[model samples]
Target: MLTQDSMPPSAKAIETAEDLSSIAFGFMASKALFAGLHVDIFSALADGPKSAEELAGAADIPINRIVMLTTALASVGLLTIGDDKKVQNSPAAQSFLSKQTKYDFGDYLRYQIDQQMYPFLLQLNAVMKGDLSDDAIASYRHWMADEEQASVYSESQHAGSLGPGRTLARKVDLATASTLLDVGGGTGAMTISLCREYPNLQATIIDFPNVTEIGWRFISEADLVDRVRYIPGNAVEVQWPGNQDAILMSYLMSGVPGDNVEELVHKAFDALAPGGKLMVHDFMVEEDRRGPALAALWQLQHMAFTPDAHSLSVGWLTQTGKRIGFDVDQVDNLIPAMTKLVVFSKPS
Candidate 1:
């Protein structure tokens, strides 16, 4: 029944079974990559090309396991192997994965592995029970406070806001605006970008003390110290500075739990003088939440960390702004990549 010619069918079945089995163990591959990064494998490659044994010595990993680890990384296209078997970083690996590059994503990878992986692994439990575990919450709080984690968060925010910010800047005339208040402006990235684009604009960054310290350094480094002032305090509880012509709440309100979002928006409204503008940029999901892969992923990631946090729709924001005595308009799809921008104005 199973002759050599007939064996091809069974052989194919066997191969398929093996592939399925390997897929079941895919987590091992991720763990291997994480282990390599934790041991500074990419950093070792940054200096120059080296063999597996040499890399192990440089990274202080066990000599016997280095070949397997290097082979695993090469298989994943992170490393290139020469005819002589020397290992080197791939082009993409050098540009982004290496620690030396300014756009290096190693910190982001480290954050995911160290801060998020454990809690994310509990997604099933969270969905089944409709709540996050205590351990997950603790890990999330740690992530939010850590500078490395905050930097990753801030960088993602900056990248997303760039297109939208540029579009808004071009559309809205800001030559007359004197002062801007950026609530919860971590690292002053958005505010700095705004100030740099609009030379006449001056801004105040309001955030927690630690974040403000980092923001101050960023502002100083950007040579914007003269234009931007760092205000250290909770944006919600603190009395916002007056005489503001505009306010930017770029990616801030979602972090505030349920009812607090309304309070924060109202506070921003009150801070603005008549005819002043408030810009809120964030990921707003469709009411159905079935599409937009990135937004859906971010929603799950947000829930694992934040209490009473969900992506707000643009319609919801407009209604809330209207209730707070401001005329609201939705800046639909400012960025080709992003979903929504809700701009509210206080009547002069």
Candidate 2:
């Protein structure tokens, strides 16, 4: 039998078996949330609290099934059942999971995590074993080569990215910037946000052909078709449009190969105009390599799908930019605790 003395420090640190089991069964809670989203459980409760029968009627399912799902969701904090016997969405679920809400990112969870990342993680064991073949782990860019997959991924990401893009707009100043190059800009959501924030800003998003094709629709819908455009190609290989007053690369560095990161930074430096700025927003760890749990988890998940993805930290990025002769302007959080934005400037 395993005794206290035999337990590793990490295992011994856990105060209770319940805590350990909760961590082990964490996937069950996630699956409950996914199933709730899949069946529109949150949407059925969006207007107000509903009795189990009413939810069943709204979902076109039997009461027993709805009750089971709602019970699971309630257990996971996505839904709550009251003394009045009505089911209601949690504040977060009502805000971000209900299809009726403006900030709905239900599809990001449904499509990206459920359909893509979940399947990609099945090969994690092989990936961690130093197996780098396509069968073990394919590059994320390779997965996006399929037009259909690219469209679905880009569309979901666009829905999820717009809020962050707006946040980024509020944080960065581009008052005098007339031209921007959004490297690997997915669906032009960030570009649209920046253009809306800075009226004089005209932007270009360079991404894969399939992704850019879908991005045009979002750009058009934002009425930014004239000000924001797409250049479809590999970001690392393409001849970037030069003389850009600013370059925004959000969530791009964490996906590319480790060897290619410095090269891309140098390229971004070359592509900027004199006195231009480069903004890199990504999942970066702390200098000590300790836990900022979500950022570390995101980097691990990215590596499961990417054969050569690099681990990054704010310190390394600051050092790389400084070595490339760019001046460090600022470093701040982008997505609350999950991401950081590092801004560097080219000399005038």
Candidate 3:
């Protein structure tokens, strides 16, 4: 029989069990956050504080539900419940959740991440068995079949990438990079961010025709049509324009088959000029794989959705990069973590 001494120490055992339990119930928190976003809680509370009754009426949900959700949101630090029983966006929420802010990412949560990944996870058993039917996570076909679906998903994802794009601009120094090739840059969010940072830097984004069309609008809206250009083509098959100062592949590595990743990096190397940089930003887990829980979970999702593709770690990135004749410059872990920027430089 497993007694207290044989099993484990009571406090340590209880804490470990509680941690595992938290992971299992993680979806509950995600759904709650989604629910708060569904009713546009941050936006509703933007101008000032809002009572549960007011939020319920605005969202067309019951006050009880709003109270519960608001309490959850408050716990997550997305909102602050005041002494008057009124709630308002926390400083973080005001910056990133309120639709009124330029950095608002509510749609990205509601549409791109939650709507896209949640369904596949629901069929975890089938996915793990590698029996996921085509329709479960149709990468290109779904967007190509319907134009509205393409536009909505593309724009929402653009919003999702925008924050990271902005962070990339501020964090990375691109003063000397005059020309850049953005491989599989969806909607030109990162390109726009980089161009805004360096007025003289010009970027060309290569994406599918449908995505490029949407990206064109964003580039034009940014009044950077002259600086940021889009070329419609497949990254792996298409001829990358030669003599580039830098090549950027963001969130693309985790989508393609792992076997093809090295070849793809070689293609970028061939396309770069001497002293050029290659920037790869994507979801990555650490070598240990035991921790960095968020990234590990993301890698698991790729097991379900992306065939033959999975997250790459910083160590793997550096190792693969060196084998391909490039220097590992720096690895950056951006805000909110998981997604990382791996910069590689071609010898001058």
Against the true structure, what is each candidate's TM-score?
Answer: 0.71, 0.94, 0.89
lDDT-wise, the better of 2 and 3 is: 2
Colliding residue pairs in candidate 3: none
- Which pairs clash (backbone N, Cα, C closer than 3 Å) in model 2? none
Candidate 1 Cα outliers beyond 4 Å, as residue runs: 1-36, 46-49, 75-77, 80-86, 116-175, 322-348
lDDT of each: 0.70, 0.87, 0.81
lDDT of 3 by residue, 150-199 (tens): 67778898998888899998877789999999998989999988998888
Candidate 3 versus truth, CA RMSD in Å, comes to 6.4
lDDT of 1 by residue, 116-183 (tens): 54446556457447676666563333555677665665554443344455666765555778899999
lDDT of 2 by residue, 46-148 (tens): 8999999998898888889888888988987888889998999999999999999999999999888888877777777778887657654557568779888
TM-score of candidate 1 against the unseen true structure: 0.71
- Sort the candidates on TM-score, descending order: 2, 3, 1
Ranking by lDDT: 2, 3, 1
